[model samples]
Every structure is written in structure tokens, then in C-alpha cells.
Target: MESKDLVSDDGRITYRSGVAARLAGLSPETLRVWERRYNLSNVERSARGQRLYSAEQVRRLSLLKQLVDQGHAIGVLAPMSVDRLQELAGAAAGRPKAAGPLKVGVVGANLARRIAASNRDGSDLVVQHSWSHLDQVALTSPLADVEVLVIELSELHDSALPLILSAARACDGAAVVVLYRFCASATIRALRAHACLAARVPADVGELLSLCRSALAGDRLPPAPPLPTSDLRFDEDALFNIMASGSGLACECPKHLADLLLMVGSFERYSAQCASRNEDDAQLHNELGRAAGQARVILEAAMERLARADGLPLPPGLIK
Candidate 1:
């Protein structure tokens, strides 16, 4: 019944379906489809019949998603082992040989200068031009000439979603990369929904270069599908029975929930700062962000279930 059984000998972490989905840049329903249709991995089920995945399994799923994005069929890739999948990914990535420095356009002058300076060797990628605003990119012509368009934003806002989408469309096939200081799960979801790529602020220039190369090579993952509505049926009688039995007091569910919330919130802020200050730590920070986001989702769902069972309305902004 222990979820730790899903972990591997190397101490790789285990994740339930929701966390696995987020880690693999997929939806839970899509994971189910891949498992049911192609038997993608030897997924383990928890005592409660929930799906669990290991870190290695998530990595394989990510590779499969990347390969499928690059025009490889899922049926062909699904049966392949993780090593084979990685080989294919490497091969696809290797196909893009830079005849000249890959042309990159940036929406922020400072980011553009940083990337340009980072590419002093002039080998892999180059920042060709930079605009102070997204509107300037629209005013300019010959958008197709740019291989990649990089947009740096201070924060992920609801208003910026359309601008990012429009910028991507304007380029007419140029890969879009969004760099932001702070991002929410909803914002990441929105960016992916529009087929644009995103990375946390202070992202490594090398990684950004690699992403651009992949994008130019036609490596594009499909947008994740919307999550299915929960059909959970709250058991009010059982909850009351538990309370009547005095077990609820011993459990201290409220105190435990508050502690969890505080820990997650604190980690989230710390991760954001780490992401902003250290380029090398950006990936880890982003992972932490996703984990915190998933935790929040689960906690919110639990709160909603509790409210429903108690016949009480949840606090404003709690569910959203």
C-alpha cells in the first residue's frame, strides 16, 4: 500500500498520476490513453487503484512525447525501450546541423544582449536583433527569416497570453520561447495550450540554444488536453462517523493541512528566487514550481471535498 514501492533502487522519486502528468508535460487522461492504447510503460497501481510512476518512467514519457512531436508515431515509439527512445531523440536532435549561426530574435534588449554575449564563439546560435516591445516585432517585416523568437517577460499575466500567442503566429513558423521571472501552473498551461515554449527566468543560454535548435528541427510537443472533471462522491456519513469516533481530533487534519500549505508556499517563493538568480538552478527551480503547483491542486481538491461533505461553501479563491 506504500507509494514508496514505486520508487527505484537509485532513490528516484515516485509520483502519482497527477504529478506524473505535469512532469511529463501531459494530462492525466492522456497518460491513461497512452497506457491503455500502447502500453507505454509498466505503470504501477496504488492500493486505492491510482496510477503511480517513477522518475525514470516520467523521463521515458517525456522522450516519447518529444519524439512524437517530431513526427514519430506513438505506436512505433511506445514499444521501444527507454534507451531506444533516448537514442531516437538524440538522432532527431542531431539532424539539425547549423550551416551558419542559428538566427534568434529577442523581444527584450537586455536578454538579447545577454544571449548575444554568451554566443561569443558564434557557433551554435546568434541573437540577430532585439526589440524593446512585442509590438515592434509586428511592425518589422521578414519574420520568417528568424529561426527563433525569444520573448522575455517580467511576469506571466493573463493579458500577456494573447500577446505571446500573437507573436508566435506572426513569425509564421519561427519557434517561440517565453522567458518569465514568475510563472504559475495556469500560465504554463496557457503557453503550452498556444503551442509556445516557456522557460523560467535566468535560464541557461545553452539550454535555450538547444531548445531553439530542436524547434527549428520540427520538434514540437502537442498541447496537453484539458483535465477531466472529477466525479468524486463525498461520504458525509463516514466523515461524521469519524468525527463522532473522536479520530478526527487525533488526526488534526486541519493543522496538518495548514502545515502542508505553509511548506509548499515557502518552497515556492524560495524556488522562484533561486530560478531568478542562478541560471544553473533554473531547471530544478522549475521542477519545484511544478511540484508545488501540483500539491496546491491536490490540496485544493481535498479542501473542496471536505467543504462538500460538511455542506459548507469553500472560501473565496480557494478552489480557483
Candidate 2:
């Protein structure tokens, strides 16, 4: 076919028989044979009599080839529309599904409430819990076997990756989607390395869903890390319940513990990030992290003692 014959008279794009066959994973001889024998493909001919196929024709031909390869007879499938062929192929493959609502724990700008309200029907995605700030997340446990965690923020830096990672670690290694207003490509790559995906927002529900699907389908979730000994002593729900229960108290004990928890938690996170980010000062940051972890252990002891004395109810894991 001549170069000029690749397009048709209607100003629509088209491909010659050879290109079309290659694109549809068929040989020109097979395409011609099918056209001659079964009228499987409709092709326009240039004035020079070279066959031309439109993109739609190519697409249909591709689907026909797919269904045929899947053991369907070409005679029966060639009559099916693109949508029906798609449905058939999907059913044959069991359709890609995340299955059930993708429960998400969130930290950023009341995102949990927003996502929860959007998914009141519970068919797709659900909010496990929403924390307005990462500080709230750092001080308490919020992950509840969620499959995804959405972190919304204005900007993301390398320093922030450890915090985000820590939250993911705490979430049983839920896939992470970081929606930000500004993020560098390098940081996005770094996020990807840690099995976190990043996108700039104002992403709507559809875009967010797409990113979430990619995060899930990519098998990007890291294995859930082992919980620290301190974590084994108290689960998130217990900490959250205790903190809420103590809000009514005038003792100021929980307040003090909350502050300590936040400080040490932040420092432990900071030190760990520092160690990872700085090779020159690795010893210093690792030492800082260990010291901070010890401080957190002491605080946890105080919290457990306080919770028991205040008659706070613990989650089933801690009840015994």
C-alpha cells in the first residue's frame, strides 16, 4: 500500500491491511482470508485498490482475535459489538476487582469524613478513621486493617517520607496514596520506592479511585513490619479509647502522657528518617532513635498504669 493510502477520503484516520493486521495481531494473509471467507472485517479500498482499516475496525478485529484465542468461535464473536465482547472478556477473566469496600485510614484535612460520606453506600471505599493532622496519628493508633491509606497535604519533602512510612507501617502496610499540592519528582520517586504512590490534588473521586486502583493492582504494598515490643503492650484502639475516656478527667494525667507520646513519637520518627537520609551522621540518628524509643516505652508503661487505674475499657487484645 502507498503512503497516501493509509488514510481514507473521509478525513478519518485509517491503516493499510498490513499495519492493521500487525496491530490486531493477525497476518495480512489471515485478515484477507477472513475478509474473503467470513466477511469478518470491513475495509475500505483506496483508488489504487489497497485495503484500508479504520481504528474502530482495528479495535473490533483485536477483540475478535482475543475472543477467538479464548476458545470462542470467530463466526459467533465477529457479530458481537465491542461492548459485548468486552463484557465477555471481562467475565472470562473474572473482572478486576479490589473486592469489597477498600477500607482506608486517612490523615489529612478531615479526609476520612469526606471519603466516608462519599461512600455511605459502602460498595467501594470506606473511611476507617480520619485524623486532621499526622500528630494525632502519631500519638494514637488509627489503622484498623485498612487496605489503603490516603494522606493529603500541601507539600511533601524527603523528611516527610518517614512519617508517611511510619503511618503505613502502623496500618498493617496498607497501600498508600499521598495527595499533595506540591511534590518534587524526586520525592515522588522516593515515595514509589517505599511502595507509596503520589498525585497532585484537587483530584476528584474518580481520579483518587484510579490512583487507589493502581496502588492496589501494582502489588506495591511492602510486607507489614513486625510491631515493636512497646506496640504489643498497647494497640491503637486501646490508646484511642483511653485518650477519649480520659478527656472527661480533671486529673491532667492523660494530657501529660499524650504530650510525651507525641514528642517521643515525633522524635523517634525524625531520628529514623535522619538515619536513613544521612549516611554521614548515621550513628548519631540511630542513637537518637533508640533513646527516643526507650522514652516511648517508659511513657507506654505510665499510660498502661494510668488507663488501668482510671477504669478505662481496653480493646479485646488488651482486655486480658
Candidate 3:
């Protein structure tokens, strides 16, 4: 594991963990921490089960480490696309970029400050203007170049609708989000009638940012991925019973399939946890987790089909 070894598997060149860390200007331990915390990708493993990083992954780590060295947080960068990370690194080096993060204007003072601080080490969305209240924002204000406007309210009612519409007009139709702690369903429906969006106060600043991104993307965002099941189809006792019943069979395939399903299902749960830990990486981790979940389901179905063919009785809960 400590050797500076190079490997090529499946025709994709790879580097040993140590070699990758060194090339990326990172210590081996830091790389391990990032891997364990972020679950960056489905990392490849050597024949001995030692970790190996693909060439592209090493290059990405080098970019990430460079940015981290310049004071960026690994948590924020871990969930970003390579192009986004490259853009951040180039900007840090005083190099120009094609474009920047989505510009967002917060109409609430407290929310603005919180978003700006949260995004200080992140990419994708930026806090542009922070007006203390909706009344303070107008047509003559810094409305230009503000792609989205986020307004926060403690309570929302019918009367406030006019002023909110006025603020939206002032921004020249920039997509608006009204985050309120209290609101009626009818009021939310009315707001949406005018091409406006409304939601209750987000549980956290990260949720707020995700809302902004999704609002702007609108129909472009893909449907939400399915979460892995907290309760697996087969319990330990059931799986053990199945294995015991398969003892007289020609092979131990049933036990092996069950073991593989358990491992894959666990990874599915872990990937979902990683997605929740950081919004930046949520999309990537969600996709990975969903894929694993789908695979687990397929494996379970195959085991059931084969078991039935071999005259094995599945647990009651597992039957269709």
C-alpha cells in the first residue's frame, strides 16, 4: 500500500493511493479523509483490495488540492464538477473565466448575510445584493445582472401581495422566491399564478441555496432520485434461513448472492448520506446511490427467481 506503484486495469490507467496523493500535492492521509468523508466517486481497488485512483481522478484531486491550499474548504469542493473547480482555481490564480456562478439577490438582510458566508468557499451560486427589507429594494436599485431574487418574510398574507409584485417588477422579471415562515395555501397559489414561486422557510441555508438553483433551472432539473430503503427486503434471520435451506443445492450461490446484495445495499445507504452532507455533491451522490439501489433490487429479484426455480421458499415478506 505504501509503494509508489502504477496500475492499469480495464484499460484505464491508475495510480496507487500514495502515488496519487503525491501527484496531487496532497498527503496520503488527507486523501483518505476526503475519500471517507466525501465519497468522491466509486473508487477503483487493486487486486489486493488497496485503493487506486484513475488518472482523471488524480488530475481532479490535484486541482482540488490546489484550491484547498489557497484556503478553499474540501467539503464545498468535493461535490462540484471538475469544470467548476477548474474555474475556481483559475479565478484564484487571477486568470479570467468564461462565466461565473449564478447571481442571486437576497431581499432579506439576515438571509443575505448567511448565504454570502455560506458561499464564501463554494461555487454555483453567489449572493449579489443584501437588502434589509423588500421596501428598500426598487427599480433604481442594483436590479441589473441579478438573475434571481430571494425574499424572506416572517409572515405572509393577502395584503403583502401587491408590494411583492412591485418588487418583482422592479427586478425586470428576475425569478423570485418568497420564503415565509407563515403563509396560507391560497396565498401561495396566487403567487404562483403570476409566475412567482413560494415556499416555507428552508430548514437550513443549504436548503435555501438548493431552492434558488432549482427555481432558476425550472424544468431543466431532473426528477428527484429515489432514496435507498432503510429496511432491506430480507432481514438477517430470513437471509440466514434461505442460506440454510440452500445447503443441499449443488452450489452456495444463494449465500453468495445474499452477501453481495447486503454489501451493495449498504453502499447505497452510505452514498445517500454523502449526498446529504453537502449540497454541492448531492446530485452526483444521488445518482450513484440510486444506481446502487437499482442494482440491489435487480440482484434480489434474480435470487428470488433462481430460488423459486430450485424449489426454495422465500421469506413471506420477500414474496411478490
Candidate 4:
């Protein structure tokens, strides 16, 4: 079987033998012999009992023929698993399926091809000379339901980070993963804080492929859009009245920002609860720093200014 023999008609695979033979550069008789001797393909039979091969089967057989030409024994190769064989074939031919182990897009088609070769599957792939290609597909292709954004990401200046963040923010179901050669702790923190993901991986295609695969498999869904002002504005009487009675202030902030603050406050509450357990100077200092830093940042600019005006500049060095 050869790739060209399988025609897609109304989303169904229709096969033709003469065409397969012409594309494979072998006689139809040889294909039949391989099928009968090796049980190689899951060939379908038409209403008249003529043999037909699905697109996958055709692609596999084409690789098998090439491997045979390269002096690999068919009998020895036949025992290997289909996936392993396809991996080898995809490597050799550079025509990986879009929905493979990982989906990737690179700035250049050659880069995408190279990455695809190392990664070994293409569930959904698009190659572009620039970011505009990705933007176009994302705008128009229904199949471009991306979950992870993988890029070589070198030569990206500092100015691009905020733009990248905005794109990731717009990808409702996607998690952006940058494959960069050089990274620092500051970069990592910025990425996480902005809800983007990134990793430092090898320049080799294989590592890039593996990173993308792992990222897509574990990527989180994008957070929902912020509610409208009316929806987000809460009636404090319902939830905060009780807190006020307990000596807590009623706070108002964006929902997401509030959640971030509460995460920071949780650590403070934990430290306060455990003040008796770990009485070391470093432990108390660490907890206090984290709590104060979170509290100040969580406040609106006006409130923060007011607090500073009131002489709450915080201790010299802290998480803030």
C-alpha cells in the first residue's frame, strides 16, 4: 500500500490498488503476497471483495516498503508493535500525523517538521513563517483547538513577555508552554504569576517533542472570564457582617486578586496558629514577611498609598 492510494471522500477512506502500486513503486501482486505471508495490514474488502487499505494502513505499508529497501528484513520488522513502527516511519518520512503524542507549531515549517520528527505524532499541527500563521489558524481553523503553546522561544526580547502573556490569556482552553534555552528564577515566577507555563528543555527536537506531549497532557483549562461588575459586586451584608462582628474588616477587591491574597493570607494564618510550634526567629520573620507582602499588594493603589501615608511602609525587606 502507498499513501496516495487512500482518498478521503466525505471523511471516509476509499482505497485504490493500481494507484497504491504506482505510488509504492511495486506490483499489486507483491502487496498481496506481503499481506498473505505476513498478515501485515487490516485491509478492507469492498462489496465485490476487492481489497482496500485505510489511510493509516497505506502509510504504514509505505514505510514498511522503504524499510525493506533499506535492508531491514520484513519478517524481523513485522513483530514490532505498530506504534514503534509508525514512530520509526514518521522519523524517516517526516510526515507525522497531526494528532500524535504532541502537537507543535514553530516559527518555520522546517522547525515544525524537525520537531514533529523527534516528537512523533501530530494531532493538530500548523507551521508558520511567523506568529501570524498561528494567529490566522487560531482565528479560522476549527481544528485549531490548541491546549498547549510550544515554541523554540529563543531570541525573544523582554518586551515580548507581556504580549505572550496576553495571547495565553486569550487562549480560553490552552496553556502556553515556552521552550527556552535560557531562563532565570525571575522568569519562572513571572510566568506562574501570570498563569502561563514554561520549561527549560534541550534544543534537540526529541526533547522539545516530549516537553510538548507532557505539557498538553497536563495543561489546565483557562480560567473563566471575570464576571461583569454587577455580578462581581457582592452585598457585603450577606458574608462580611459576620466577619465584621468577629473584628475582621469587610474587604472589596477583584475576585481573582482577592483569591490570590487569600492564598497568601492562608500562610499567615497557618504561621499564627503554629507560632508556639516553631518559635525560631527565621520562621516568624518568614511568615510575617509573606503575610505583609500579600496584604499590601492586595490593596488597591489608593488604599496602598493611604496606608503608606499612615506610616505603614512595612519592615525593611519582605515578600511585597
Name the best candidate (by lDDT). Answer: 3
User: What TM-score does structure 2 among the candidates reach?
Assistant: 0.40
lDDT of each: 0.65, 0.68, 0.71, 0.48
Q: What is the per-residue lDDT of model 2 for residues 240-273, given as tens digits with 9 covering 90 to 100?
A: 4555555546777775675557456655665666
State the local distance difference test value for candidate 1.
0.65
RMSD of each: 19.9, 17.7, 20.6, 22.7
The top-ranked prediction according to TM-score is: 1
Q: Tens digits of per-residue lDDT for model 3 on 1-320?
A: 36665657557778888889999998989988999999875778878897888878888999988866543456668999889988877765663222557787778646765565557576756776778878777745547777778898745666678888888777777778888755656777677666566777665577776666545543110324567575466654455566556555778888788667755765676667667765887888789888888898788788778777777768887667
Predicted structure 2: lDDT: 0.68
Model 1, runs deviating above 4 Å: 1-100, 220-320
State TM-scores per candidate: 0.43, 0.40, 0.37, 0.30
User: What does candidate 4's lDDT look like per residue over 1-320, in tens digits?
Assistant: 34454444556675776566556666788887887898886667766676776766666777777665533456656676668776755554553222553333443223454444443344334332224333333443332455456544432324456656555544544546665434444655566455445665354555555555544443210122221222212222211222122222244333333333333333443333344334555455455645544453444343334334443332222216
- Spell out the clash pairs found in candidate 3: none
**What is residue 146's positional error in candidate 4, in angstroms?**
1.6
lDDT of 1 by residue, 110-163 (tens): 566656556768676776778988777766766776888889775555567877
In angstroms, the error of model 1 at 283 is: 30
Kindly indicate the candidate among 1 and 2 with the higher TM-score.
Answer: 1
Candidate 4's displacement at residue 24, Å, is 54
Off by over 4 Å in 3: 1-100, 120-122, 219-320
Instruction: Point out where model 2 deviates above 4 Å.
Output: 1-97, 120-122, 142-144, 219-320
Name the better of 1 and 4 by lDDT.
Answer: 1
